[model samples]
Target: MRVSAKSDYALRALIEMAGRTDGHPVSAEELGRQQNIPHGFLQSILADLRRASVVVSQRGQSGGWRMARPASDVSVADVIRAVDGPLVSVYGVRPEAVEYNDSAEVLQHVWIAARRSLRDVFENVSIQQLADGKLPAAVTSRTADEDAWQPH
Candidate 1:
């Protein structure tokens, strides 16, 4: 599955917040600079994050955005869902909801397994881990696979 730019920017913006101390706010401009996301796009992404209660916004002189919860408590999947909705889909429908014809009966398991595979990584990875440069063992193991880094 392809991750949308919206999800990508939201993740970056949140990571910017994650990199900061708890309760500290970082402005969109700063986040954009640090994350290499565009300022205007960051604003829209931040708005969605704010609406999702994933990030809190402030007004005035010291105003900026802070994560609503501790970074460690927020998973990458959380940010993805907040911005991108369902993590996996089959022809635009949820994996479980997809119906397959007799000839494609085995496809159901394939879709379910695909979503499960993605969740295994995305759900276990937290923003704090990414911001702190730590990765879950599963992710590390996967990345460490000799061929994982090879461009297919």
Candidate 2:
């Protein structure tokens, strides 16, 4: 499945923030500059994250945006969902919401399983782990096989 640019940008922004040691907010423009994302686009993404309670916005000169919770408590899945919608969707519909003909019914299960696989990785990983360049065994193991990094 293809990940949306918005979700990718959100993850990058979160990772950048996760690396911060000063506990100070970072402006959208700064985040965009650091991640090479468009400033306006980053602002929109930040707004979405704010509404989701994933990031809080601070006003005035000394304020900007910061994670609402600790980096360790936020998962990539949370940031993605906050900026982009569900983790996995087919034809704009959730896998479970789509029904198929009797012969093609198994396709729905395939989609569901695909979503579960995505969840297993995204949900299990936290921003802190990402910032620290450390991933859980389950995540690294998936990439243990050379074929796992190859284009299908």
Candidate 3:
């Protein structure tokens, strides 16, 4: 399944936050500049993230955005869901909600399995681990697979 640009940008912005050294808030403009995401798009993405409690925002001359919790507490899946809803969906419906008959019934299982596989990586990957450049063994193993990097 294709990941939408919203999910991609949210993840990139969060990853940029994960890499911050200073505790000061990061302005949306700076975040967009650093991550190469459009400023307007980043603002919308940040609004969703803030609503989800993934990132906190402040107001004032020195105010901007910062993580609501530590980087280790936030998973990539969390950010994706905040911006894009479910990690996997068939058409616009959730995998489990899709119905089919006879031979096509087995197709639901395929979608379920796809969601499971995606969760195994996205849920387990913390922003801290991403910032440290040390992915979990499961994620590392997948990356190590020669086929994983190949274009479909």
Instruction: Give the clash count for each candidate.
Output: 0, 0, 0
**Candidates' C-alpha lDDT:** 0.85, 0.92, 0.91
Off by over 4 Å in 2: none
lDDT of 2: 0.92
Best by lDDT: 2
Give the higher-lDDT candidate: 2 or 3: 2
- In model 2, what is the error at residue 103, expressed in angstroms? 1.0
* Per-residue lDDT of candidate 2, residues 1-152 (tens digit): 78889999999999999899999999888999999999888989999998999899999999999999999999989988898789888888999999899999999999999999999999999999999999999999999999999998
Candidate 2 residue 60 C-alpha distance from true site, Å: 1.1
* C-alpha RMSD for every candidate: 1.5, 0.8, 1.0
lDDT of 3 by residue, 83-150 (tens): 99998988889999999989899999999999999999999999889878889998898889899899
The candidate, 1 or 3, that scores higher on TM-score is: 3
Among all windows of 10 consecutive residues in model 3, the one with the lowest summed lDDT is 9-18
RMSD from true fold, candidate 1: 1.5
lDDT (tens digit, per residue) of candidate 1 on 109-140? 98889889988999999989988999989899
Per-candidate TM equals: 0.92, 0.97, 0.96
Ranking by lDDT: 2, 3, 1
